[model samples]
Target: MDTPQPKQLSPRRRRALIFASLAVAVIVGTSLYYLHPIGILAPKATAQAASTTLFSKPDTLVSYNFESAQLGWALAVTETRLNQGPFWIFRTVDGAKHWQRQLVGQTSSLFLTLASFQFLDPTHGFVAVGNPISLYRTTDGGMHWLALGLPYADGYAVTFTDPLHGWFLAWPHLWSTSDGGNTWNQLPDPPVDSTPLFLEFDKWNNLVFRSRLEGWLGSNGAGQPHVYSSADGGHSWQRREVPLPSGAVASGTLRTGVQALPGAGVIASVNPSTSPNALFTSFDGGTSWSEVTPLPIGGGTGDLGFQDNLHWWEIYVGALYMSSDGGQTWNHISDELPSAVSSLHILDSQHAWAQMFFAEGSVLAFTADGGLHWTRANAPQPT
Candidate 1:
């Protein structure tokens, strides 16, 4: 018998059959893959680089020395003489890389004097200006600052524990504000004989009230720095004497900046004296204090900020020093920076920012590896 001849389907039917078979195979393959999954994609690597870059070069203003405040955000203040007018406030939200100048009407003189600044949050803060304490409040961050008048004009240190409660130390007394700096009430004059020129709040409700209370007062003012503790807010205070180290004398005056470790009941204060760079720590919540070994460059007027309860750092003569053992010992970390630093701030144990003031003006520097290496940030111009 001859080979059976197979009948071919129509061309259209053959094409349709081929397409339908392909569609069926694709559908089955998709369904099976979805139903029973297998490793189809490559795995991503978990090991990351040792150090990550957080900020690049910063553009800083002309003023080498300015104040910085840290709440949820960081803020710096600068002054410039633009056409013989007062310097406007230039602020940066992105860690000082860029800044925006605030326009808050013209003052009698273009010379704006920002004495002190404190922020309860990134948005809410107070800025003190002039001989008479003219307090300004900003609810919408630092974009705009509105005046909140306090009777005391010459305010030194301003602090806010929360949005509702804040304090400012003028020459003779301490002022408290509970209504987000809307109004102020003076606390009974602090227990010290002379006016309390400087003060700081410890986490344990202890006030490191300084000035004539512990140091010298009047024209020939110069005395040993004394620390006072107030358990019941500012109602009462107990004097705590910080013992000087074995060789140093307790003759030097305490500086304005005071930092307290609230969790560890440790307080750090700058003592500018004839002795070695003096620093003090109080373990008993300001009731008692002990002197910490000094840093290399001696302490400057800038404040000391603690990285943690154990590590403390200070800025002096454009260099940074760190103490790992609760201020007992210190190591110089200045060589890691590019320029001489004016102010130093520690956001946490790992992150820190320093404003370097050099002959070429100022530059903002940030370090992610705990001050090991620093990179510049773009600073804002003062309006």
Candidate 2:
């Protein structure tokens, strides 16, 4: 007897069943990007040793962390040749003088190493990478990596308040690791469903951990706009009602762009769906919020970065703005943003670095005189 073939759906039906998902990267370190071979602009700073090559081709870079002038990490994935291609990491030390690459894939695979990476310091870090998606830790500043032996979980976003205490998040579930990710235990949560109430399509993913027990969750895909504060790590939550923008019928929540500042303050950009063209600040840890002055940029704060509570930067469509008195007023730091900066790690009022998107690819950029001058930096690559 001949074997039978599986049934096939019609083209119209197949098309109707298709769906798409956006990959988000929530990095808990400090990092950004730029690649150059003597770029159109000359080198302006001497802190960077030399511009280096991270990958030979274009790739997706996410979960960036630049903890200091000499420490940073990020996940770089290339889908150019998918199964037969390479998935590598981007690491820099020695002040971006030379970058070392660690390959994660020997052959092609559909899996991403992890959704994001959290590095507490130059010597300790954690990431969720593997076929079934497992957690890994690096103690020697990512020079070598090992698995935590934790059970397979879909966790892609993680945050750490210290070297040994952190939180892991997947949708609808939150886990805690007190032993530096060697083990993880599921934490208690509110009676709400798996999805978060607010939403953002990017990696900011609406999550920030202020302490071992206090954290802020921005939005999820399946709910209304509401910011949830978890005082007991993820055990339970209290809703901090936010004021809706003027002319808005109702207030909603957003995923990315929720920034936690010193002294239990939070600055968040209101989603257009929730309100429209406004940012808010909360002094009482989201118990209540007040609309601040509009930012200098006439756009959303998708790629917002902060040097501190009083100093800020907003990156959108190649434009960057700096604010001093909250968002009441902003200074156009860079008339033309080098690229969409993922995060800006300001070493001081002058020295800073950023991981960003440029020409549809990942690259590194740095500054020595605030935002006035920028020089492309290098990323990690193979030895």
- On lDDT, the leading prediction is 2
Residue-by-residue lDDT tens digits, candidate 1, 245-322: 446555535432234463455454434456444556666665666766656553432336667777777765445678
The alpha-carbon root-mean-square deviation between model 1 and the true structure, to one decimal in Å, is 26.0
lDDT of each: 0.45, 0.54
Report the C-alpha displacement of residue 172, candidate 2, in angstroms: 2.4
- The Cα error of candidate 1 at residue 301, in Å, is 12
TM-score of 1: 0.63
lDDT of 2 by residue, 163-190 (tens): 7888766655678888887788987754
Backbone clashes in candidate 2 total 26
The positional error of residue 208 in candidate 2, measured at the CA in angstroms, is 2.0
